[model samples]
Target: MKKPTMTQTLLFILVIGIGLFYALKYGNKAKKDIAEFESKKETNTTTKEIIELKYFGEIDLNKTEEYIDVLTNINGNEISIDLNIIEETISKKTIQPTINFLENLHEIEKIAHKQVLSDFKNGNIVKDYIEHHIGEFNDDDLKSLGIKTTDSPKERKQKFLNKIYLKRIGFYPEEWDSLAIFDFTISRDLTQYLIVLSFDSNGKFVDIYTES
Candidate 1:
């Protein structure tokens, strides 16, 4: 075989040098990317630790399992605090505020319960109930219940309304029964009415209204 000339040898050496240079550059870049990812992961963990310590004092926030505790018992009503509920309903950005609210939940619960009852009494619950069921019964439906045909529409409606009466509070929607912080079930005899109360992450009462 013929030996390569000086120019070929020089070209080969230059190509090898370029390959090594790029290999080292990309290898270092990959290592740097990994290091940065690890650093960010560590920073996030540290931040979570700080937040837990700042807000919860001695409570262990890093528990891998579900955490639940009895929150308060007011007037025979036993309220429970479930970490899973807060984690699901509350956003990460508002987690701190939500935690702060939970810390004072015992007192807040009483106020919330009272306000809900007051609102139920003073609000449109009765009117809404009447309106909902009044149009439901036709002449045939009323007559089946032994109402006289001579009864006026106004009288027939009043008779229907008379049969209906608000039963009690503390009812929950079938689907969201376990989810809501507070649910007031209003019933007219056999029929069920739903009133859902919503609160913000900061534990401020947002609204209390009936759901269709």
Candidate 2:
């Protein structure tokens, strides 16, 4: 073929240049997208399940009246006495409970009992005691406490503050009418934020969240 005309040659070169530029841009975009996808794949994902975690909703410490109102609604006509036996440093030789559930630690501890725990460990009586007396949720919740127990009565007498694997069920005597096992706890560090709870034997929530 003969030499192409100037304009024709220029047009051909322009088309090739545009094609090359487009190829480069698309290649770069594809590479960037792949790199982003790989980066995302390296990260871990978490899942969460929501559930009602309180009584009468959440109690607000700032709104004293609000707590009073809810407490009235729940405590009024309910079989409970506002025991002013105000304990200053109430501590039990309670064995630290092994944390059962990671996500909802306090909730699991709420329903725990001494005898039931003794049964679970097959003979870990001492640990159950420490767990009940100690706050239930403490990070691992006593996962590290290596306490043991036994149904076979302690061959040797248990001493005071003697760390043991035991369980505790804080409930009103069976003879009492209209039973209410309203168990509550607060931060052992004097954060009197009441851990108010109200539930029946059937897992029904009388007061689902904080009264306030």
Could you say which candidate leads in lDDT?
1
Each candidate's clash count = 1, 34
**Residue pairs of candidate 1 with colliding backbone atoms:** 171-185
Where's the lowest-lDDT run of ten residues in candidate 2?
A: 93-102
> Model 1 misses residue 9 by how many Å?
5.8
User: Each model's C-alpha lDDT?
Assistant: 0.51, 0.33
TM-scores of the models, in the order given: 0.40, 0.27
- Candidate that scores best on TM-score: 1
lDDT, residue 75, candidate 1: 48
Per-residue lDDT of model 2, residues 23-66, tens digit only: 99999999999998988875433232222213223222212121
